[model samples]
Target chain A: MIPNLIFILVFLFASVLFYFKVRTIAHDINLGKPVEIRDNRLMRWMHMLKVAIGQSKMISRPVAATMHIFVYVGFIIVNIEMLEILVDGVSGSHRFFSFLGGLYPVLISAFEVFGIAVVTGCIIFLSRRNIIRLKRFWSSEMTLWPRSDANIILITEILLMSAILTMNATDGILQARSNQHYPVVGSFLLSGFLQPLFSGLPDSTLIFIERFCWWFHITGVLAFLNYIPYSKHFHVFLSFPNVYYSKLEPQGKIAHMPSITKEIKVMLSGNIDYNAEGSAGEIGQFGSKDCRDFTWKVLMDSYTCTECGRCTSSCPANITGKKLSPRKVVMDMRDRLEYLGRNIRKHGKEFKDDKSLLDLVTSEELWACTTCNACAIECPVNIDPVAMIIEMRRYLVMEKAAAPAELNAIFSNIENNGAPWQFSNEDRLLWADNLEIKTN
Target chain B: MDRKKIEIPVMADLFARGKKPEFLFWVGCAGAFDDRYKKVVKAFTKILVHLDVSFAVLGKEESCTGDPARRAGNEMLYQMQALRNIEIFNAYEVKKIITICPHCYNIFRNEYPDLGGKYEVVSYVQLLNAKLEEGKLKLSSELFSGISVTYHDPCYLGRANNIFDEPRLILNSLTGNFVEMRRNRRFALCCGAGGAQMFKEAEKGDKEVFIERTEDALRTGAKIIATACPFCMTMLTDGIKYKNREEEIKNWDIAELIAQSLDL
Candidate 1:
């Protein structure tokens, strides 16, 4: 009973700490962005409801959806099992779930059915991932933890659930031998098969084994709770904010370019003080080389990505033989930011000037983007890769002047001639001259 | 021969009557410059005149609206052009305007508002349909016999401004055999003319977007491919030639059909 109380206190304390740690990380990443409250209140609410509660966006692919649904439902239904574990720890009794006469049986049966559902779902999921080898389900950035952790968690859950069923059956048999009324016939039937092995065992041995299984289940759940913030399983909490704070603007509106003309004027006038705030360093308008250049919202978007390849599949530029995959762009940026953040956290002042990590992204990949919003539109998590691309382009154009030659020519043509075409305005009226029409 | 004198005469006539029209008919760069569209513009003008709706033209003073400049990413030139047009309109006290070209209509109605310019803008088809509904203009049925036509919804008019039904209404009133392309209205494909692609050569793709759209119109099996935008008409006409299907398919602006149906 004392151990059970300690377990409850430890679990509650760990969960609260993990929640705050994730919240702080999310908050720090999203600090500078303008708050994007969508204009349509009802539409926002509906989208939130569909994405957060329904898991509608994550279920886009069949195999991944099935696997995720099992894990998700297992996490939910297993809470009742968690209560049983806690109660067992408190009372030192294996029949903790059987407290309320008929109610206990009903609850046990419900959990048993859900456990079977979860096991079958996870089995299908594992087979699909390992055997079928679906390319879309594979993430280049999948960490070691979730990959192995998921398998371990699933196996442990199944074993724990099976052990609970076995314990109940064994208890039913013991109860029947002692002449106590057992509620479930299936429990008695299950116990009948195990009665021969248990007949020779002492009562104290059964009690010790039941207590061992209860402790194992309780510890497994507590460990999972502590591990949530440190792992990719953090997406469970992050998905809600990711869906709610989606970009409200039309996809076509690219990130606003900084007014370089005003800055250039001030710089040339030798009044560096006046233009100090807006002046670019010697690198010029090149492109985003590091995480600091990314908008705060983009950094948030990076962490929120489920590594779903829906963005990659729908991207027009990627389909058209371009090196630009919007999914890779976000993932690569996230990788670079994480790498840089790790270095900054560890080495601090010593690695302040270390530009080697900035080479994580290439200039070609940055320039190849068409700024099409297909990635943003198809992204179930509302990750705006287009916004990130535009920010990178802004840096390339303003800081480095390193944009493609074709784009420069286009700008020049618009500058010198009134139109993109060099055609003489004298001949503009030629198409209208011979028509049999009255002038306005 | 006096260009300025020629421009202000229509405005002078409006001033002489001590009354200003609701809109000045801004016959845009395409309407004033494209030969095929000029006839359509003239037909629209005739309809307005017959309906006794007062309007004036800017004549030679009206240049390009800089939609071509803006779409090509030269915001400076676009701003200059837009500012110049706004000044001229403000000077004339033109509170409302109508344009025949959807590109011009979109620039004037939608884009110009962003540059501190605002005016009630209408497409000619909208004005024409309203006039028709008011019974101010009448049409003869001789233009309709054996004329199987289909309306190609220009992307700017349909998708950009949501002006789908006005053109369809005019076509329906003019001819009974107006078929629709498989992708019509909002889903209408671009004729590869928008975003300044009309002035420049098309980018190399697996298939020409213009040709693809033209073939869609051709597949409708209509003799006449009717459109409301001058750019669509020109591109679709060129697309027909490129596909070697010009003999099988012909392009006509909606106003031209309406003009042909007019008793005059």
Candidate 2:
């Protein structure tokens, strides 16, 4: 009864916490532009299934891929044990696993071995993250909390599984001594090792230890669920929608530049009078300087990043000694949005200062990008960093009139001569005239 | 200036009169303007005529497709120029527009749609391949006597439009000995001429991207460097000159090869 009550209280508390965190993230993402769908419904579903469930993104990296597969499989299979614990705690009878017949014990044993393998695999990943520090893993922008939280969660999981083994061993010993011929005594392989410690303990003492472990396991699961929405673990939920809604157009296609004349006409002629109301200037030009400048889809992308470092690792700019890391750009945008949300909540509609977020990303980092889609192609979460970079460049070029001198000269030449070359337009047909081919 | 000029027959009313020509040859800006490219364009036209494909030229009515302007962020000018070209195309009722230049092909096929223009666009290699398959074009026994060649995949044709096979197929069918550059197909390196860089000087970097790409082509140790795009041909030719490798390595458009190989 006590164990059941503890499990219910912890589950309810965690559920409430998760609800609020998810709400805040959803609200902020909807504050930007709406997502445009280009792919057919069937194609979108196939992509989602392949990328989200198949772990296509994670498997791109071989070593990490293998480790993740084991952990994912173990977590899914072990969920049945969680249900059993919940039921047994309420009824005071651990019959769930036993009801499956002769094969149930074998299945449990197989899962037990796989759980140990998952624990081992996780340990390897933790060591790699801290010691080997692979370039992709090192540059990941995962929140500081999630990294340490993962380690704690793994250790606690190992402990809970160990406790389960110990309780089973104790029960086997007690039953053997009481002449209760149990069919599963042969399956409890750890009984001989645990006999020295719990052979003299009373059956009641053994039962108390089992109940205590059951409560710890349930509480740990609840805590993880509650913390998921607030941590980098939020990617688990966001990754699906992010991949499904990913841009289907060719990577080189730039966003359609909005008509400048139409916007100006609307501002001047509309009854609402945006210019008169002081919301816009005489020559209206829309550009994003911070997180809010991005569309809602871009904002969602920022939060959906798993910080897997696939993007940064594949980035030519980063590989060639440039300061721009596409992953960092997305993370920085997310951080700024969160910061601005806090300010808006406190100051309401009058809040204005975004100088800090603007300062976070430099023009050098922005210009260093070659607009290559390598980062986007490599990202497991389908975050289009190239689009974000180009969007920022558009703002820099069109609104601020700030760009590299050479690029500026090129644009000027194109505007004047209809070519990037400085030569006279009269010489344009010189190549044709020199050819042996007859003119029309 | 005493070179034998190849005559390109003019037929502005061919499409309007419902005459089904073998091919509608598109003479791009480079083909019409660049000195070296003009010879190659003439050669390409002669080869198509030899293949018995009745072709027509746009003559003085042809204008810039505005690809350079669009790529350089001058969208307004691109729209203006594109609209003008669309009017010409519509007037001629051009159905299948074929060009030796990958840039012109890309603009006509991809960018023209955004400006409300539509036409069936094909590259020179694609048209030539069809002729070869139909046995209209045949390879000569004289194989240039052991001259090795390597094909450079232009960004527009290879990456932008996923056209890597047709050029290679034509080259392989023409010459038994053909090698590939290290970076080919989708992973091919840019010739630094893309995104309107051909019209402007390259920005300061450790090395010129075009030169680097040309070096990759030269590293294959082939006697000749072949390309389908006029921009790439011009850029690679200049790169060879810059490296003082003009004496060692030569550049040729695919059309020039077909023209030279023809029994005519």
lDDT of each: 0.63, 0.69
**Model 2 chain A lowest lDDT segment of ten:** A431-440
**Which tens-of-lDDT digit does each residue in B112-205 have in candidate 1?**
7766679998888898888778777575556786777888877667755677898887787777788899767644556766655565444433
Instruction: Kindly list the per-residue Cα lDDT of model 1 for residues A183-257, writing each as its tens digit.
Output: 333343232455566666666665555456556666666676666555445556667777766655434333332
DockQ of 2: 0.21
Per-candidate DockQ vs. reference = 0.11, 0.21
Chain A only: TM-score of every candidate?
Answer: 0.74, 0.83
Model 1 residue A117 lDDT score:
66
lDDT of candidate 2 over A268-335, digit per residue (tens): 56754555633334434445677777788898898897666777776545654456788888878887
> How do the residues B47-104 of candidate 2 rate in per-residue lDDT, one tens digit apiece?
7756657778776566667666555444545566677778777766667788887777
Q: How many clashing residue pairs, candidate 2?
A: 7
